[model samples]
Target: MRASPPPSSSLGSSCQSSQCQTEGNCMTDLGSIRILYMEDDPGLARLVQKRLKRAGYFVDIAEDGEQGVEQYQAGDYGVLIVDQNMPIYSGLQVLEILSQTGELPPTIMLTGTGSEETAVEAMKLGASDYVVKDAAGGFLDLLPPVIERILKQYRIVEERQRAEEALRESEARFRAVAQTAVDAIISMDSRGRMIFWNHGAGDIFGYDETDVLGRPFTMLLDATCHEKNDPPMSFFEVHGEARMDRGIESLGLRRDGTSVPIELSISNWETISGVFYTVIVRDISERKESEAKLARMAHTDALTGTFNRHYLVGLLEREFQRAKRYNHPIGFLMIDVNRFKQINDQYGHTIGDDVLVAISHELVETLRESDIVVRYGGDEFLIILPETNGETEIARDRLVAAMAASGRFVGLVDFPVTLSIGCAHWDPQDPRTIDRILNDADEEMYKAKRANHEQEGSRAQAPPTFA
Candidate 1:
């Protein structure tokens, strides 16, 4: 090997040190740029190395092209400076061989003064730049600035490639999420015309992408509601500001011309093209149906499907206050099925429940819609008549006549099916408590029951049974 250049200069540092030799399998350390120079002239190599080292570079020298390639493979370098005329191989030959290993570093080719043709040929062989050399060594001044410019260009290219790669990955992730999501994800332009429809939107709306890509977004809403909404109401876009929603309920018109309940959330983004909106929609029909069923179960009697005692308590309090305020006439009918226990004991509880259900239905059908019927207790019902207008007994008589005409229990095992009906009128001006008024109706009912028993003692027949 040629003697090592003086410590004052090197074209590339001898990486006898383990760290530099193995770095990324030859990737240079950018923090400290190290360079390799190949030249047959020892004096010229030494001068070049010293000048570059003074310019803040670590430099090492190889005597010829063959040695230059060998030293390059053995060390990490940020730059390469090679002489065109070498003792064993030409600088172009060295460049051609080094290209096979991997990408070469920012490189400068050294040529004799006035040999611009040789310098251009070196550039074609992958040299980043070329330096004109003379006996006086005027080329050193150009070397540093040329190296800095080439390095800057390399960094710009790498940054551009990374940015393009990141953008492609982001687009791929968006396509995957949009294609697989279960909720309808729809995109609309600032004017609210549909632009992108994904798999979820097609499945929900019963339309192909081609069928609705250019349609108005409001086509998915009920006609009556869509008119009120238009496009401006669907999203909040004020100036450059955009707003997002947690959820808003709406009616969605399906392709089959039916309406479905849906919930929507929206997001907005802006691009050079203009503003855009994305809407996510979820179907809520099942939730609405469940809520309605639960509400009914909470307020109605489970066995007979009539308003239960709990509902009646609230209803009575409101009605009581209203009557006391306006001095209106309110009537109560305390109705009890005669011998209901004897019917259940003879016919079984199954029939007893059926009888109660039938009675509840009959009471509802007989009364005005404004009237209230409550299953007050086993075998007992309370009917409320608002603004009775002195027709309390008349209303009770009409119910009895209707039940007889319907023959509700006439053939049920020959049992004498009858009702003990008692009426109590609320005198709004009186300071009596509701409990006392209800007690009066109860006492009147017992009196009616006793009278019915005395009147029918000779005629009442067998206990009721299913017909």
Candidate 2:
């Protein structure tokens, strides 16, 4: 027969058959919790087993520590309660074996009185807790609560591990995307010091990680740009606590000290440590060059390389407005190539085209840099002179001299090629529109042409004097 179970205030009296029965429906209500108990003392083991079984726990008993290891491996137990002073292998030795084999369950070590050193050693070997058995066997009362507490703590640890694993996987995915991005991706601190630079940054800026990490981000900005604005600062510096998302077009300096047009976007993120800024940069140099080329093609004449009619009209309107506002004198020269159609008829259109090209070159060389020359139409051109008074005749004389010196018509035609020029000056004192001034110059040009025709076709003719 088993020895009478150790006396307990609650387990023996309060836990009677009616209150804590380990039978059918009652046992099902108290979830199944299998416990493995290893103790060298038969009397103590029998008493503890009876108390646990009555409380609806399924208890498996082992005679010594060595048997405890075999029972633990053979059966599934939610908790292990082993005696520290067991024969052969002790509680600490059993814990070591279980730990080496695999994961151990929630464990509690039972030590004899004044064996605090053994209890400490057991705990260090992976026991969750240890109890000192009293002469009255009072330690048996503490086991249930200890097991519950250990299970709660274990759940907490498992949750924390899962969270850490998820964070690591997220970081890995972000790194993979950043490494393969085509645009330069960079991260910096509030002080504009580089913290991270990806592969695209190296390809765009020609600086490897070793060369740029920990350096100021201003190293990649043109010196002139830095001087024009504030010192290169992160998005956090400008906006303070607010989140920023914006893009700017600026010049980025390369490793070789040359600058490229760059489109930069800034985004800010906040963490417990501080705010960080992410910058995405794209080189726009090729796009800028393409736009400039398209603009030149729109405003310039393909054959003569002079200002096209569209651009010339805009220039004239702008100049007229300026002259009206500033009370400045402006001059206009309307010129026509003499006998151009007759030359084309006599020597084919190719010779006529050559003559027109040569005339355009001569006019460009003769005029001052401030003068505006335009290829207005077939066999016709316009020259605009700003901030001039009483210089119209001087300009006409220069053009005649330039044409005589130029040998463009020598081989193609027997007669000399000359220009009939009409001049008109805007006196701020006179009230006249741009259209009126242009019409007057055009009418005078035809008069010069008629006069030259009447005078046995003089090489060049000048307009009449204006009052």
Candidate 3:
């Protein structure tokens, strides 16, 4: 057989590298394109090694079918290209053994004689593809892309499995946080049945988590509790839209059939299985009472239990954003107590503070519920009116008339208290940041003060109002 002349070893890219066998094959980096070549001919094995390596594959050569099977048992090779005739065991016998295990790598059978019967026999023995020795070039060309594609698919499958494992770990972390949370974390099915309730839920609701699981969330509500008639749906029905941030309140019934206030934030989501809702509930009994105290503290001037300057600035920011988004107009009115320092110097700081508080009460009683009145500074206050028009002068006139009718300034001991008005409408397109808007309002307040001084020939309280 003249050793087949080793198939031209020096053919450059057409053949594998000279040092490839001893140098370790370069194709190992191609990710799953490892190949096992089995033949009794040493020269043929070397030739095959060179060719396959050049084609970007990791190749290991064995002289016998026995050695080939041994190499396959080791990890990380993907395709086996076998010579039909080999020492000790024939290629057919190797294929039979591999088939029995049902874990065989895909194989390309090689026959030296190019007999159709031999090729057919190889196929029956589980050969994935086959080639004759003289015409092996064609096989080599088709071989790589086929094996490459198979390896690519295998890699994708492995990656997906890895990703799934990572998702499982992430979900476990979330569950741990939910279990340890101080506020109750509850999840419900699309039908409003409670599916998940944390330990906090049981502690706060006075029900065992097990007893509540699978029950309708409405079961927690007391039938005799005073109900809100604003919406036709029961609180549970309203809660379905809660996750959409429709509103932040939800009413919860206690285990003892008593109504307890709850502040709820909800979220809607879907998983591989189906749709679900998650609700975070905080018992607001303590919070409401605390808020009431804070409201009284906030509404009262701090010096006199009336609204503070902080309230004015906060309301302006809120109203500005709201008016900008909805294209509604907002009005701002700034009020300053006139020449009260003389009264303070004579009547003392206690009376000065009382004068500030008394003025705030008059402002509060003078404005509508929809209006927000805030103390701007020492002896100064601001009011905000929502849903005003492009021109808020009529609204300004109403506030001025109300202040005059309240007779707040008539009983002043030293100087008469008066308000100077400057009003501007919010432009939706050029709506300013809260600081900028307040600065503009403050500037207008100064202008109004100057105007009042110019008109009355004396310093008078000026409440500048903007829309």
Candidate 4:
């Protein structure tokens, strides 16, 4: 036979559970978390207090159910753990008193096998969760999950209250700023039902507040919603609420059947009986267009519309890596006009520019799609050949043949323009050093120029232009 716990009384200690000193305890380390623990057994109360203290909890102990009720009524405890039997009252009685408040802290009742009826009564009286004492198997194991569940509920409730208060505060702060937020704030429910649509959202989507509010979110997603075979269940499914900070780019089909790109972030939460989603959406059509323009500019040569030197360098590096990775060879050639400066000076600068343009056109026609013909600089060009024997003399011969076939002449005598060429190959095992390779090609080009000059019996030729 066990004595009944004390009856309910007005709460004592304005601090009550708040007074629990979490110093040197796990509960304290866990952060200002509070608990109310009631037991008629003094020894058991002491044992639990010690354990809980070690776990960093703010634990307030009561010797009986009546004292527990008084402590709880003072409020501020995050959790209430009550024993079913005590001297003046039972856990059920305290639970009954707390149930009437409609806003009591989360409560867990402790009962022995003999007090099973009391446990049922405690539940009816609104105990959140329960634990069995003395005769338990897995009692200690069961304690954590019960406490965690109740505490989680308590925290959820408190957080929601805090969130509402904060949202009000935020709304006040954002009243002026909301007009200028880069993105619109739109929201819906867990079921994809719309709850909010801000002015910015309306402007971006070409919809008015009256048209979007009280409507399903799918109306905004429109056809894009069904694009995926297994479309995401909700915004939360695609981008979790936890990662709401990292925005997602989504395609939104407007009311006019046109598609607009949008960056979206969503958060899902509950308030009272309703669940809501808060989405921040920004129109990214301008951003996308800007990016596209930048990409083209990055890859293009302003003067010739061919790959720029920077892009060409990147392509060469890529090809080099590929050849190295696959144990393959690549061929490249450096070609310079035999007497370009004299052509520039005699023909005038306008004709000189035209000559370069013509040369580029002729080179493009002569090269394979796999080959790159880049204007290395004024009057000098580079050709790259993938999967070729770099040492093959045919590489230079090809350039010579292509230049002759172009039929574009710079001389007044209609003499066919010519290129003096030098070629090199990449060897993965012994690397074709960039400086040495280019230097070798330059040397060969100069050698070819000398040979041409000697063959023509004219050693009085101008040097290559620096450009």
The whole-model C-alpha lDDT of candidate 4 against the native structure comes to 0.68
Cand. 2 Cα-lDDT: 0.77
Instruction: Note each model's CA RMSD in angstroms.
Output: 9.4, 8.6, 16.4, 15.6
lDDT of each: 0.76, 0.77, 0.67, 0.68
Candidate 2 residue pairs in clash (backbone atoms < 3 Å): none
Off by over 4 Å in 3: 1-33, 37-51, 63-66, 69-141, 189-195, 206-247, 254-258, 270-275, 289-467
Per-residue lDDT tens digits for candidate 1, residues 1-467, read: 11111111112223354664664232223337778999898988888888877766788899989999999999877778988889778987887787756667778888885587887667676777787787776787777677766665555555566677798898788878998998888888878888888888877788888988878888888776555654643534421232243577778888888888888887877889888888887888899999988887887889988888888878899998888788897999999998888888998888888778777877888888988888898999999999887788888887776766665665463654568888888868767788988888888888888877766785645321110
| lDDT ranking from best candidate downward | 2, 1, 4, 3
Per-residue lDDT of model 3, residues 314-429, tens digit only: 65667777877888877666666656676788788877876776677776776677877776677666677788665456755775677666665455454555566556556667
In terms of lDDT, model 1 sits at 0.76
User: Candidate 4 residues 1-467, lDDT tens each?
Assistant: 11111111111121223444532211212335577898888877777776666655567898887777787777566667888877788777777777766555567788776466776677667777678775434464466556655554545555576778799999777655655676787767656666666678777788887787767665666465454434334546656644467887778877777889888777777878667777788889999999988987898665666666677768877888898899888777777876678777777777777677777777677667787777777778877778886343675665567776666754542455777777776677755576677677678777877777665565345422211
Give, for candidate 2, the lowest lDDT window spanning 10 residues. Answer: 1-10
The TM-score measured for candidate 3 stands at: 0.41
Model 4: how large is the Cα RMSD against the reference? 15.6
Candidate 4: list runs displaced more than 4 Å. 1-185, 193-261, 265-269, 273-275, 295-299, 390-399, 407-415, 456-467
lDDT-wise, the better of 2 and 3 is 2
The per-candidate count of clashes, in order, stands at 7, 0, 18, 18
User: On a 0 to 100 scale, what is the lDDT of residue 353 in model 2?
Assistant: 89
| lDDT per residue as tens, model 2, 1-467 | 11111112111122235653553223122235577999999999999898777666778899998898998888777678988788999888898888877766667888886577877777677777788888887777776566656655554555566677798898688778988998898888867788888899988899999999887887887876565456557333643433235567778899988888887877877778777788888888899999988998899988888898989878988888888799889888888998898999999999988888888999999998988889889999988989889897688779988887778778988877878888898877878877899899888888877776765445335432222
